[model samples]
Target: MQYNYNISRITLNDDSHQLIGEILFPTINNDIVLLEHVFINPTFEQQGFGSLLVAEFVKHAIHQKLTVKLLDPFAKLEFAKHPEYQQLLINE
Candidate 1:
């Protein structure tokens, strides 16, 4: 089997495409965009793809002027190590 992976923004009603991974942010009244979940297909984990996906999401959040609120800090710590992500860190 072969797998191709990419990052995409998906809503609850939209499921036409197969998702290798996803980061979900629930709608709420706040300046912070909560990263509710981050998932990668097992076949794709630990190969740097997760970080790339996170970086993409971070870019999206920053563009919307929302701070990223990571619910699972440990899941994101790997991606946060990249220097470009320093500004997005929320003090815990």
Candidate 2:
């Protein structure tokens, strides 16, 4: 299935304008974004929304030239499989 999600620091809403998921990348300074949390509605879990959020975050990080410090376990597993995305993560 294909899903188009808006990667925003604010929120991600569905067609009805209700929030279905969100990926939080809070900035600590100018060169890093911390992937603090990823939330998907229970009804939406296991449908790949989490993966999509991580993908979007990687894209955003590329654009902003930011390194990601991931806090979520799900995001870690998602990144582990994608070597390209793994490069964007902070080693420490």
Candidate 3:
């Protein structure tokens, strides 16, 4: 099934919109982005949105030439399901 996905990034202090899901990268320094967290509402799980979110985040990191430091297990699991993303495993 095709899903219309809308994921947004929330920084440390920006609170102006309703967040259905968020992937946190609290530290962006020295051309590196620490991809620390990824959360999708429980009601929204298993619909393939989480993979979309993580994939988009990785694309953003690559586009900016920034190294991604992933610290979330969920992110790892999601990436594992996608063979194309295997090389981006930061912990490997």
Cα TM-score per model: 0.63, 0.82, 0.65
Error of 2 at 1 (Å): 12
Best by lDDT: 2
RMSD in angstroms between candidate 2 and the native structure over all alpha carbons: 3.2
Off by over 4 Å in 3: 1-18, 86-92
Query: What are the root-mean-square deviations of the candidates from the true structure over C-alphas?
Result: 5.9, 3.2, 6.2
lDDT of 2: 0.76
Model 3 has an lDDT value of 0.62
- Provide backbone clash counts, one per model: 0, 0, 0
Model 3, TM vs. native: 0.65
How well is each residue in 1-92 modelled by candidate 1, as lDDT tens digits? 22232332422211444455666766444655567777776756676656666766777767776666667564468555777765765555
Best by TM-score: 2
Ranking of all candidate structures by their lDDT, best first: 2, 3, 1
| Candidate 2 pairs with clashing backbones | none
